[model samples]
Target: MTTANFVDRPATAPIGEDLRGRVAFVTGGTRGIGAAISRSLAWQGATVAAGYGSHTAHAEQFRADLAGELQGHAECSVHQGNVGLPDDCRRTINEVIEQHGRLDILINNAGINIDKIVLKMSDDDWMKVLAVNLSGAFFLTQAALKHMVERGSGRIVYVSSLAGEIGNIGQANYASSKSGLFGLTKTVAREAAFQLERAGKLTDTGLGITVNTVTPGYVATEMLASVPEKVIDKVKSSIPLRRLGRPDEIARVVHFLASDASSYITGQVWGVNGGIDM
Candidate 1:
């Protein structure tokens, strides 16, 4: 092609094709799975903005790490906020969109684990888990849905756990919130599909937005790093891969889902577990 033609090429023309010109916001994206997602998106040509409650140091460090990988590829930044509050979620995501002019992807990855039995679990326990895990996602998605609905494009993924599906000991509240998110995904898909079908917008048929979930199993991170050695050994022994999953592994899936390649998928739960759970 001529030089002028090349200059006029599409955004993903020079680089690889994954998520070019898209903007994404990730919650609880500092150093673990969320950071991985942020980095992956940046590498794929998506301008990524990550939100964190505290630990500004960690968030900035992640930004620096991604900045190196996405040089001349894409852009990324970190925002500080609490994902559990509707106002906080609104402020964080809206500001990003207001600045970027659009938000094409959202990863509600912040979650908490308050392990306790149902009988012994206080109301606060139940509410706290739900607030951060389920309610937080709800709030962000709620605000972003307007943009996605209006633009007829968006991708949203919730970072869940196998415990959300199979139910683990001392995680009744957590499981409940994660499971509830599944319903939210399905419900949004159903509603958005109905609107598009009625309007006959075949081009935007994937719910005007693709909503999905990613369930990870036994990831080895600083959070899990605190566990006793024996417990870690036992957990790793049960994995078919004989090891815990890395952050980048999960980030890879997030990249695929955020990209156009996963357009046909929605309202489904994908497991990043090492072949242990379906």
Candidate 2:
């Protein structure tokens, strides 16, 4: 190709794609990895609806941060709802569509970890983890699928964990929920592809709406604060990189999946575990 034909673009182009007018919904978007994902999407020009369950103060602070950091490059609004509840999921999805006029991306990042040995775990603990981590993703995706299928394009990225891939001690409930998301991601990818084909919207590569998962290893977040420092040190030692993955590192992968660069990619799990899974 001629030099003139090869247009050199800056490495930082907002969102790596021209998502100037898209709409995205991120669950648990007020903190940690979800916050990074929300900011990344917003920076790329998508109007973001950040969903949070509790943590009103944290959520409000996140909104303020976005307002200051984004500087009107994009819009981000906070919505309160528990993804575990079907009613809340439905209502939240409806609210996003009503406000933004469309929904293009759905990030199932809301999750809770209740670490307890299987023998000692309570029914409430197991159920709560699964409901929030696994079922919530399904409920939200189901609610958003209608709009995506009608529009014939969408992106769904589930936030899984390395614990799900390689089971962690005293995290049976959390592991199961994260593993369940793998199945959910693949199934949804196939179904959405079928729908797009039926609608005569499939690309030449037979691709349409994409569904994927991102598995992150240890990260320095409030969630990790619950872990004993000694345990974290042990984890760091185990990792080949001898470090924890950053939320933004995981968000970068999510951004790629959310962008047009990953148009032909679906039903995949991108791990950001700093060689821990190797």
Candidate 3:
């Protein structure tokens, strides 16, 4: 609430190098928006653990390319896990900590969508979406929280969707899962603050454990590869920006939220949707 509270806070590094000496874990980090997020964080000097589900080849390629591009400036390792499984989520977090020694950032970006109207949507479709998108984020965050709280510093960012804010016609399952992230964000933010304070980690300068969400509009990713061109055109026209969002654009917002610059921010849903109305 006041500048005095923020003075003298320790940072991982200077603003530009804020992520130096930090480690981040990104779910679904091998492709699409998730890949962009992993790259952005690593570029800022964070060692990243990128999680993938079934795409072994794609994940390996991403790791190789990112490593080559960074050229030892940063480190990225790929981990395989089904985020929807609670045990897998916990194991992934433990593995990252075991490898990197610490995890300072968590990006819950793994998600899947099965488009179907409510009436036509089967229970499997709805449950699958929620399992991967909503439940997975929760379990991953839960596993990461203890470590982050013990260290007295961390960042958690949920990558949501614009459809969560403004419902889509045939994506009831996907929209529900995405919207669920909003409640999860707010609740976790409060709990993290409370736990930090209880552990004597909270101070006038802030402990820096923060939880937030980033909702992106239609991004030009493989996710849209199957959509008809005409439908894509119509969707773009509906957006005020007259184009689908880019992965990097979403990543930029995520980059900020995961940095020390966002220490004072939490429990908020940031829209990076090219001016699309909520």
Q: What lDDT is reached at residue 142 by model 3?
A: 96
Instruction: Give the candidate order by descending TM-score.
Output: 3, 2, 1
Off by over 4 Å in 2: 1-17, 205-207, 226-228
How do the candidates rank by lDDT, highest first?
3, 2, 1
The estimated TM-scores of all candidates read: 0.89, 0.92, 0.92
lDDT of 3 by residue, 35-119 (tens): 8888888888899999999969988998999898777888999999998899999999999999999999999999988888899
Query: How accurate locally is residue 118 in candidate 2, as Cα lDDT from 0 to 100?
Result: 89
Candidate 2 lDDT, 61-147, residue by residue in tens? 888888787777788999999888999999999999999999999999999988889899999999999999999999999999989
Residue 6 in model 1: lDDT: 21
TM-score winner: 3
Instruction: Give candidate 3 regions above 4 Å deviation.
Output: 1-16
Question: Model 1: residues >4 Å from true position, as ranges?
Answer: 1-15, 198-200, 204-208
C-alpha positional error of residue 167 in candidate 2 after TM-score superposition, expressed in Å:
0.6
Model 2 TM-score (2 dp): 0.92
Window of ten residues with lowest summed lDDT in model 1: 1-10
TM-score, predicted candidate 1 vs. hidden true structure: 0.89
User: lDDT at 141 for candidate 1?
Assistant: 89
Clashes of each: 0, 0, 0
Best by lDDT: 3
lDDT of 1 by residue, 222-257 (tens): 677567888878887888997778777787888788
